[model samples]
Target: MKLVLDHIGVRVGRSMHLDDISLTLEPGSFNLLLGPTLAGKTSLLRLMAGLDHPTSGKIRIDGRDVTSLGVRGRSVAMVYQQFVNYPSFTVYENIASPLRLGRRLSAAEIDRKVLAVAEMMHIDKLLDRLPGELSGGQQQRTAIARALVKEADLLLLDEPLVNLDYKLREEMRAEMREIFARHTTTVVYATTEPQEALLLGGQAAVLDAGRLIQFGATLDVYHRPASVRVGEIFSDPPMNLLAVAIERRGSGVVRLSPDLSFPLPSHMRALPPGPCRLGVRASHVALAPSSPADIAIPATVELAEISGSETFIHGRHNDLAIVAHTAGVHSYRIGETVALHLDPQRLFAFDADGRLIAAPERQPGTVSGAA
Candidate 1:
């Protein structure tokens, strides 16, 4: 099912839910709709599911117009954040309901399909149990199993495991990926978690406000965000941005501060000397210098947020606030002076309008220097 959204936009009353969004999901392609709250992730999913109509543009499945169609008119299955199931029906019955309603398969075939998906979801032992008899994670697995049993051409999962605990969510994500690889259905998954998108390892359509910000392979999009806005939204702690003045020497160079400066990346050699923005991921910033070329910026610790086995040190480098995501839980008192080391090679460059002009070399697409 080649899905195409031709400049789709959704307007309700005075608010616009989607704006001039155009995208294509190849048949059997797994894609992620990534954004924060009110970023139009759900709106786009609803429009794709045929639950909502676009105010403008068109939608096509396999080049056939389906813009005006409703959910009942398409071979689409959707699983929401909440675990939705028939309260009175057992897990097996719930998984078989779609087959029964469509009247497209015999009882024996439906039984086979239901059991297979149930096992795949690791809920085979709970088939006879009702939704109320299962744990939150089990109920979600049941809901997902039901969606998978339908064998719908398109599957929309709107944060299906969001309600589960941390351990359960991690477990479910690995299984979900394995399941998705076996099915040829075009999957459109929506989530607010940037880590989830990265784990999925597929193409990503990043949304902001009501507009389509960037769309491409997940890692490519992550390493080379089209703009500062995309970088900020795609990052977990958000990318740290520093305003700097670019000064071109006889060759290529940039002056970030009186004591900090480095040669311009190869890609930015032709950029005129003036005001520009530098973006570096939190993971790239360190509390200690890693190399001789590293720039040590003196900062006062503002906050030290410890999550799991890592600590995110929030510091103020003059007027700029930077977050350093480092391993192990480290303690730092407020107003403590620390030098944040930055690697010039990993810096992302952006222009005055907040658009990215040069991206550093990254994995898989690795180059000798910055390009």
Candidate 2:
């Protein structure tokens, strides 16, 4: 079933939880919603599932207006991070409870349907086990099996993999994608993890402070962010933002910072600017052993972190703290003086209002000092 949210807003007590959010989910499409805490990602899911009524606007399912419909009236099912299962019931009983309690089905039919979903979820061996006996992952799979056995039209997952370890999370992530692909259920997924968003959903919607920031294809939103906030959201090390003043020098030449100067790109030369923020991803910044004349800035490494597959080096330039990430291993040490160079061509500037500005053109005769 296709799900459409139009101007949906939810208010709890005096505070607004979701504000004028709008999205349309194509049938069988996986839509990922991401945000920080209090961003209303889960609130939107609850509204879509008919668990909570919107204070304003409408929610439509398959062209039918279901804004005021109750949870049971809408064919939507939700599986939350905390697996909701009956402690006293066995796995078979938990999976069969929905059918027994809500729908009219014969004993033989309920058993057949329960067995089918159990097999599909790989939880057949745990049919006789209670919820407490199963591991967290197994319990979650049972909850998912309960939903699928009912053949829900819309599947709402609220950070279903959030509690698992990295390895189990990865394994369940693949399982979820495969199950959704086979069943073709309209799905709305909510998560704070950017990697999970990109891995599960073809399209992603970013929410900030209860407002919808941007929504589009995952690659489009990641590579070309609409604003500085959008750029800072998806990346691992986060986007580096620096405050600088833009000054025009010698006709069309523009001085971005006091020490760093370059000619403005043809498009940016016409803009009026005073104070601007430069946004660059951590991967775009590099360190050079020898300081180049024009592009490199002197910095002192304050700290370095070495993970299994990546290394993060934290350094300071003037009053700004910057971080750079590299794969595998790095040789930088704390208190070492390093020359940091930013890729000017890949550098992005945003005005005080958070609007992105085009990078200036590279100098014709000058070569880039660092990679």
Candidate 3:
């Protein structure tokens, strides 16, 4: 199904949950809605699923207006962050429930569909078990299986793996590509993690504070964010931002401090003079200088967060706080003096209005400083 949301806005009394949101989801295409909590990811999904009517604008499914349609009238299946499954019904019956609702598929056909979907979700062995008897991951798989068994026209997943354990989440993440590849449903998955958006490698629409911020191919949005806000929201640990002044000297010069100044890259040549915001992804900020041309700044380490095989070093360069994301475990003590190296070519130049004027050239797949 082709899902088209035209200027969709959801207003509840005085509060705005969605503002001028417009997107067209092509048939059989996989897409992602990424943002932080309360960013209107769920609200947008509800609008897409016809669970809630928009206060303004229209929603069209396959070129036909469906803005006034209710959830019962559309061919849609949604899985929430919470594991929702029938506690009393056995897994098989739960998976078969949707098919039975139509009262069209025979018992034999229902059994075949249920068993097939259960196997696909790796929950075939637990078909006889109740939701109460299964592990959290198993229960979620059952819920997902029930949704998938129906093969609805649109499948909406709102952080479906978020409640699972780390290992289970990782396991499911690996299977997401293969699992979705088997179905023709227009999949719309929501996530707060920038890494998950990249890992999924689909079209991504970024939302912020009830507004649609940016939308495009996943890598394009990651590599060339439309604005400073998009960069911060789309990057893990957020993009490091610093206010700087740029003078229209030879090749243009940006002065970070009295002692730090460098010629801006050609991409930033069109930047308006005077004050500008410099954006550097945490991944591109190196811990040490690779060459003399690399700009080095002295900073005091504030904290070091080690997550499995990765380490995030948080430090402050003067009043500007920065986070450096890198692979492997690295230790740093509070108050330790360290040098951060930044490549001018890899810098992002934003206009005073926070709009992106220039961005580092796209490189090979690298995000959160991980390969």
Candidate 4:
């Protein structure tokens, strides 16, 4: 089954919850809606699941307009961030409740379905355990079993791993991916975690302030963001953006900064003349023994952090504080003078309007610079 949303919007007084949201999900594809807190991720999910109606526009499933459909009318199962199992019921009874309450199966059928789901979720061992008896992770597994037992055409998960501890969350994420691999149901996962979005999504939509910032394949969103905000949202330390003026040289070389300048690749040379931002990831910011004559800026190391696998050096230059992460142990004494070398080809150029002007063309070993 296919799910399509077209120009759907929801407004609440002075606040617009969703603005012209549009997306089409293929059958069995795992899709993610990701954004920062209060970005309306949950609101969009609820609207898609028919639990809430948009103020305007439509939602269609298999070409049938379901904008006015109620939650019960839509063939979807939602697993929420909160583990809402029945406190008084055992794990077996909780997993079987959906089957029993729906009345589509006999007692024998319900038992078989419940057992199968429990086994798939690795919760069969806790069949006799109540919600209180099981740990947080087990309770979440039971809730998931219940969701899967219903056999809906679409699976809706709203931050389903948010309630679990770090280790448990990782484990459950792996299990969830396995479950998706075995089923052909369309899955819409909502999360604020960029890593989780990449891990689970075949496609993803980046939402910000109810606006669809960008939507496409996971790698596409990361490698070629639609705007500066998008590039900032996908990296850990975030993409390092610096203001740069485009100065025309006889041969397409633009003066990027007071201490840095590089020839505009053939692609960016003919582009419109205007103000722009230069972006590079932490990994691309190179530190040399001294500033190069062509381009270099004096910076003072603010701090140096060693985190086992890599070292992070936070420093300041030209009134700009920058963070750089490199593999293995590196040493930079606090308050020491240093110079940074940024890869010209690795830079992303954005216009004054914050829209992407030119992005780094992918080459081997390029890290999608910062979220």
Cα shift from native, residue 36, model 3 (Å): 0.8
Candidate 4 regions exceeding 4 Å error are: 265-270, 286-298, 303-311, 327-334, 364-371
| Residue-pair clash count for candidate 1 | 0
Cα RMSD to the true fold for all candidates: 2.6, 5.0, 1.6, 3.1
What value does the lDDT take at residue 194 in candidate 4? 72
83-165: candidate 4 lDDT, tens digit per residue: 98999999999988877765567888888998889999999899999999889999899988988898888989989999899
- The positional error of residue 176 in candidate 1, measured at the CA in angstroms, is 1.3
Better of 2 and 3 by TM-score: 3
Per-residue lDDT of model 3, residues 188-231, tens digit only: 99998887788887899999999998999988988888999889
lDDT of 1 by residue, 264-325 (tens): 76667767889999999898898888889888888999999999998999998767789999
* Candidate 2 residue 53 C-alpha distance from true site, Å: 1.0
lDDT of each: 0.89, 0.79, 0.88, 0.82
Worst 10 residues of 2 by lDDT: 362-371
* Candidate 2 global Cα RMSD: 5.0
List where candidate 1 sits over 4 angstroms from the true fold: 250-252, 265-267, 365-371
Pairs in steric clash, model 3: none
User: On a 0 to 100 scale, what is the lDDT of residue 179 in model 1?
Assistant: 87
TM-score of each prediction: 0.96, 0.85, 0.96, 0.89
lDDT of 4: 0.82
RMSD of 1: 2.6
Give the residue spans of candidate 3 off by over 4 A: 364-371
Instruction: Give stretches of model 2 more than 4 Å off.
Output: 106-112, 246-256, 262-274, 288-295, 329-332, 358-371
